[model samples]
Target: MAENKRDYYEVLGISKNADDAAIKKAYRVLAKKYHPDANPGDKNAEKMFKEASEAYAVLSDPEKRRQYDQFGHAAFEGGAGGSGGFGGFDFSSFEGADIFGDIFGDLFGGGRRHSGPSNGPIQGANVRTSVRLTFEEAIFGCEKEISINYKEECSTCHGSGAKPGTTPETCTKCNGKGKVMYTQQSFFGTVQNVQTCSACGGSGKVIKDKCSACRGSGYVIKKKTFKVKIPAGIDNGLSVRMAGGGEPGVNGGPRGDLLVSAVVSDHPIFKRQDINIFSTVPVSFTKAALGGKINIKTVDGEVEYEVKPGTQTDTKIRLKGKGVPSLRSSSLRGDHYVTLVVQVPTMMTPAQKEALRAYDEAMNAFTKNDEKTRKKGFFSK
Candidate 1:
C-alpha cells in the first residue's frame, strides 16, 4: 500500500517544508476542485477528493506529520513501525471534522457521524452555522435569533415514510437487520464486510405506499429559528454547542446538536487580549507636564481617569476590574490598560511660538541656577 500510494506533499502540490497554512491552502484548493459536488458522478474526481482528504488527515496533524517525515508511509503501515494503521486518524475528532466539514457539507449536504447499532436507533446529524457578533455584544453577552434550513420529520406520515393508511414492512434482503454481511479474499485469508441493505437503504424497513409529503424519505427540508445565548467574553472563532437542537433522530434516538461559530467584530477604540482590554489615549504636552482628570472610553461607558503630575509619554495606567468578564466565571474580571501618548505641537501661531520661547528661557535660567547650586556644594567641590 505504501509503495502504491503517492506522497502526501506531492498529492497536495506542496514542498516538504510547507507550513500548516500552506498545506491548508493547497488542500482547500484541491478539495474544491475535486469535490464530488463540483464534479458530480466523476469517479476520478471522487477518488482524488478522498486521496487529498487522506493526505490532509495525516499532514495537518503535528504528531502524524512528524512520524510521516521520519518513517514515511511506513509509520502508518500495520506492524511496519509498530503502530496501528490509520487508527489515530479518527474522522470524528474535532480537528478532522472541522477541517472536513467545510468541504464535505457541499457534497453531502452535511457531515454525519455514524454510530450505534446497525439495525438500532441512530443519532441525528449535527448542523453547523456561523454568527457575527458586535464587540460590545460579545463582551456583555446577548441573545440572538438565527435561522437555519434543515431536515425535519415529515408531518403526514410522522417520520414512518409510509402512506397515511399503510405501514412499512421489514426489508427481506437483510431480514430487518439493515445490513448484509459478506466475505472477501484478502492476504490474511478472508475479511468480512458489513454493508447497508440496498433494498431499504439501511432503514430496516421498505415502504410500498410511500408518503407523498416526504416521498418516502421520512424527512423534509424545513426552516427554523432558534434563539442563541452568546456567553460573555466569547471570543472570535469559538463555537457554542446547543444540545438536542438538530435534526430528528432515527428509530427514537436522540436528536443531534447545533454548533454555532462566532465571529467577533473588531472594535475601533479597544483591543482585547484574553479578558484584558487595551486602548491608547492621546494627551497634550501640557497635560503630560501638569496632569489632571481625563475622559476615557470603556466597555461600560466613558469614565474619568486621573493622570499623575509629570506623567510622561507612553505611560500606562491600569483600571482595576474595568475589562471584560470571564466566560467561565462571570464574577472574575480582568483589568483595563490605558497607554498615554503625548502629542507634540506640529504647527504653532506666532503668539504661541513667542510664549514657548519665553517658557524655554525660564526653564534654561532655572536649570543654570540649579547647576550653580550643585557646583557650590561640598560634594561637587
Candidate 2:
C-alpha cells in the first residue's frame, strides 16, 4: 500500500540529513508563509500550515525525530504509538516545549516552558471567619478586632527556611528549576515527562541547616488580630473581603484575602428587609379611634407619628428615609414601615364599662336615625 502521509522532511522542504537548526529555519519560513493569519480564509494555506506544524512537531524533537527516521509514520500508527501523537495534539500543550519554540515563537510571540516553579507565582489560600453583629451595630457600621490563626513567614529565617546566619542553596537535582525532565519510550513515540524535583520538593532550593524556629518549612502558625469594619446595611451571610489579609503566600506570592461572613443578631422590636426596617407599634383602642400622637422608636431616635382616626389594626404607615443607610451610599436610606396595632383592655372597671356602654348606645341611635333618613330619600326630598 502507498504511504498515506508525506515524509516530515519533505513537508518542511528540508533534506533528510538536515541539522536541527536547518530544519527549524525551513519550518519557520514555511510557517510564516502558510500561517492562518497571513492566508486569511484560504483552506489550502491552512492545510499546508497544519501539515508543516505536524511535521515540525515530530522532527524538532530528537527522540521523535529518531523514531520517525527509523519507522516513518508507522511509529505512531498503532499500539506502539504511545500517548504522544498529533492525533490528540493541542497547540497550547506545546507552549513551553522546545520542539515548537522557534517556529511558534515567530508565529504567536515568544514560547517559554511552563514546567516547575517557572510556571509563576501561586496565590495563598483564603481564610474565612464569621463576625457576629448586633442589629443596631449592623445598621450603623462598627469596627471590631478579630483574632485568627494563620500561616506567617518565619521571622527566624525571614521566609528562607535556613538558619539565621546561613542561607538555602540551589537544588543540585533540578538546578533550581524545581522540576526534572525525563524521556520515556512508548508505543506512540517518545514522551517527555516533567515532574517536581524530589530533592527540593519543588521549592528549587535546599536548606543545609534548617531553621530551629520553623524547622525549614519557612512558615509558622501565628495569631493575628485585625480590625474589620462592618458596613451599614450589611445582612446576615454577606461576606466582606479584606484584600491580602489571609494566609501568607508561597514562593513570594501575594497573600490571599480574608473573607468575613456576617452574622447579624435578630432584634426583638424590629425586623429588617433589604435596607428597610419594619416594626409594630401598639396604640390604645381609644387613640386609634379618636386619633392621637404616638412615639415610635427608630434607629436615629424616638419620633412622634400621628395615628389616623378610625385606623384599623395592622395598618402600615411609612416613615420615609428613616431606615438603614445604603452600603454604597451612606446618604441614601430606605423607608421605615410602622404597623399600628390597637390594643383593647381585657379587664375594665365598672366606671370604664359604663362609659363604653353609653358610647355604644349613642352609636346605635345615630345609625338608626341615618337609616330612616335614607329610607325616606327621593319623595321626601
Candidate 3:
C-alpha cells in the first residue's frame, strides 16, 4: 500500500516541525484515543492506531526520520513491493517494549503477551558471598572451604519439576503457542491483539501432575560447599571470582559466577600496605649511641642488623625483598620497614650515677680552661 500516502506528521496528528516531547505527547494522546479496546468493532479506529504507531516509531529514531524526510516513503520501500514497505512497516525491529506497550496496551490489556519467557539458554544471576580468613592464612596463602545456600536443580524430578515416571505436558489453553490472540477494532483498523497465556506462565508447558519434592519449580534450596584458593598477599576487602560456581540456570542455561569477598583478620605483629610489611622495633639508647648488632624477629625467624652509632629515634631500617609476595606476580615482593625508637633510661642505680658524675667531671675540664683563657684576655685588653 505504498500508494496510500499520508504524511507521518498527519498520522501522528502533529505539525510538520514537532519537537521530540511534542511528538511523544501527540502520539500518546492519539494512541489512547484510537486504542482497540476503547472502540471495539470499529475499522477506522484500528487503522488509525496502526498508522499512528508506525509514524511515531519512525520519527522517534533520528536516522529513520532523516531518511524518511529526505527520501519520503521510498526510504524504506523496496522496488515493486518486496520484503519492506512504509505503510507495511515491520514492527519486529521496534525494540522498546515500553513504547510498544503504550501503543498496544489497550489492545492486549497493557501486556505484550506474544513475547514469552526467554527460552534460549539464559545464564543464572551472579551470586555474592563473603569469607573470613586468619591473618596468617591471608599472608601465607591457604585453601579454604566455604559454605553457601543456593538454589540447585531438584534431584527428584531431574530438574524438570515433573514427578517420577511422568513428564510435563504442553499447555492445552494456548495449545503450545504460549500466547492467545483476539481481534479488535482501533482507530487504524481491525487488529489482532496477542497476550501471554496465564495458564502456563508463558512456558507453553504444564505439569499435569506436580512433583512432590520440588513442587514443580525445577529447583530446590540446598546447602553447598566449594573450595577456594586464597592467593598470598590478599588484603582485606579483596575479592575472588569463581566461574560457573553459582546457581544453575533455568531450562539448561549457563551457570552464573560466584563472587567471594574476603575479610582478612588483623595481624598482631605485622602490618601490611600494598605487599609491604611494617613494624616498630625498640632499641636501647646505648645501642643507638654506640652502635651494635641487634636481633629482629620476622615471619621467617630472627635476623641481626647493625645499628650505626648516633642513630636517631624513629629511624627506619629497610629489609629488601622481605615483605609479602605479590598477588599478581608471585616472584615479586615488597620491602619491610622497621622503625626504631630509642628507649631512654627510666631508672638508674647509685653505681650508674657515680659513673655519670665521673663523665661530667671530665667534660668540665674544657669549660674550666675556656674560662681561664677569657679572663687573661680581658686583663690584657
Scored by lDDT, the top model is 1
- The C-alpha stretches of model 3 lying farther than 4 A from their native spots are 1-117, 171-204, 353-381
RMSD of model 1 against the true structure = 15.1
lDDT measured at residue 346 in model 1 versus the true structure, 0 to 100 = 99
lDDT per residue as tens, model 3, 1-381: 555868898787778778888888888888788867788898899888777777877787777788778777667786433236534544444432345465666556576544545334568888999899987688788888998987888889988888989988988988876666665544333455566668876567889887899999888998889999888888898888999978787557888999898898887778888888898889998899899999887656678999999999999999888888898899898888899999988899999888878878976997899999999999999
lDDT digits (tens) for residues 77-172 of candidate 2: 654564445655544444214543344456677543353355257688899999999999899889988889978888888899899999899999
| Estimated TM-score for each candidate | 0.67, 0.68, 0.63
Quality of model 1 by C-alpha lDDT:
0.83
Between candidates 1 and 2, which one is better according to TM-score?
2
Q: List the residue pairs that clash in candidate 2.
A: 80-187, 80-188, 81-187, 81-188, 82-187, 82-188
Name model 1 segments beyond 4 Å from true.
1-116, 379-381
For every model shown, the clashing-pair count is 0, 6, 15
TM-score of 3: 0.63
| Of 1 and 3, the candidate ranking higher by TM-score | 1
Which portions of model 2 miss their true places by more than 4 Å? 2-119, 180-201, 379-381
Which candidate wins on TM-score?
2
